[model samples]
Each structure stands twice: as structure tokens, then as C-alpha cells.
Target: MIRTLIGALGGLVVALLILGVLATFGVWDSIGRVASILGGLVLGMVFGQLGIFIAVWRE
Candidate 1:
């Protein structure tokens, strides 16, 4: 149970770190696509992992 929580939090932190790096480098300044894609990808990964955790816990 704790491992699952750590995994989820770690995933979220990593995702935010990626976003921060991109924003810091001004990579999304001229393009909106990258920001949107990154946001969706990170969020999807976080939620996906959450679902997996819940399923495993239930079993």
C-alpha cells in the first residue's frame, strides 16, 4: 500500500519536473502543442498508475 502511494507521488513529481523544465527553457513559448501534449501525457500516466494501484489493492 505504501509502495503504491510512493509510486503515484513520484510519478506526479516527475511529471511536474518535466513540465517545469520545458517551461524554464521557454520550449513552449512559440508552440502551444508541446505544453498541451506534455500536460496530458503526465496526467494520463498519473491516473493510469492510480487505477493500477486501486485494482491491485482490491485484489
Candidate 2:
């Protein structure tokens, strides 16, 4: 459980780091700043729920 928590936190840190670097380099900015954030949030939520659904189904 602890390892899972650590891995998840590490993954989140890496994801944020990549996003920050991309935004800093003007990559995400070119995609429309606010739109990128909104899209990321929506996609993240959808994918997260999909994972949960699959996990439940497999049980």
C-alpha cells in the first residue's frame, strides 16, 4: 500500500513536471492555455473513471 502511494505520488510529480516544462517552452501555450488545462482535467477524469470501472469489473 505504501509503495503504491509512493508510486502514485511520483507519477503525479512527473506528470506535473512534464506539463510545466511544456508550458514553459510554449508548447502547451500554443494549444490555447486555458483549453489545455480544461482538456487535461476532463481527459484525466474520464480515464481515471475508466480505470476504476475496469478494476471493478475484473473483481
Candidate 3:
């Protein structure tokens, strides 16, 4: 469970980093601020679930 939590946190961090880079490049400008934020959250959730799955599978 701890490992899974760590994986999810790591995934969230990675997602935020990716979002930051895209925002820096003006990729989210057309989408607007709220939509961009929501998208990032959704992306983070997906990555987090993937991380959890990997952690559980490895064990």
C-alpha cells in the first residue's frame, strides 16, 4: 500500500511537470485556464492509476 501510494504521488508529480512544460510552450492557451487545469487533473488521475497497477502487479 505504501509503495502504491508513492507511485501515485510520483505519477501526480510527473503529470504536473508535463502540464507545466506544455503551459510554458503556450499549448494550453487556446483551451483556457480552467479546462487546462481539469485536463491536467484527469491526466494525473490516469497516470496515478497506471502507477498503482504497476506497483500491485510487480508485487
Question: In terms of TM-score, which candidate is stronger, 2 or 3?
Answer: 3
Candidate 2 residue 15 Cα shift, in angstroms, is 0.3
Q: In candidate 3, what are the lDDT values of residues 1-51, reduced to their tens digit?
A: 666666667766776677677778888656477556766786777677777
Q: Sorted on TM-score, highest at the top, how do the candidates line up?
A: 1, 3, 2
State model 2's lDDT.
0.62
Clashing pairs in 2: none
Residue-level lDDT tens digits of model 2 in 1-59? 34444554565666667666777878854647655675586567556656665676677
Q: Write the per-residue lDDT of candidate 1 for residues 1-59, one digit (tens) a residue.
A: 77877887887788778777877888866447776776788688778888988998999
lDDT: worst 10-residue window of model 1: 28-37
Poorest stretch of ten by lDDT in candidate 2: 1-10
Q: Model 1 clash pairs? A: none
Per-residue lDDT of 20 in model 3: 72
Higher TM-score: candidate 1 or 3? 1
lDDT of 1: 0.78
Question: What would the TM-scores of all predictions be?
Answer: 0.66, 0.49, 0.49
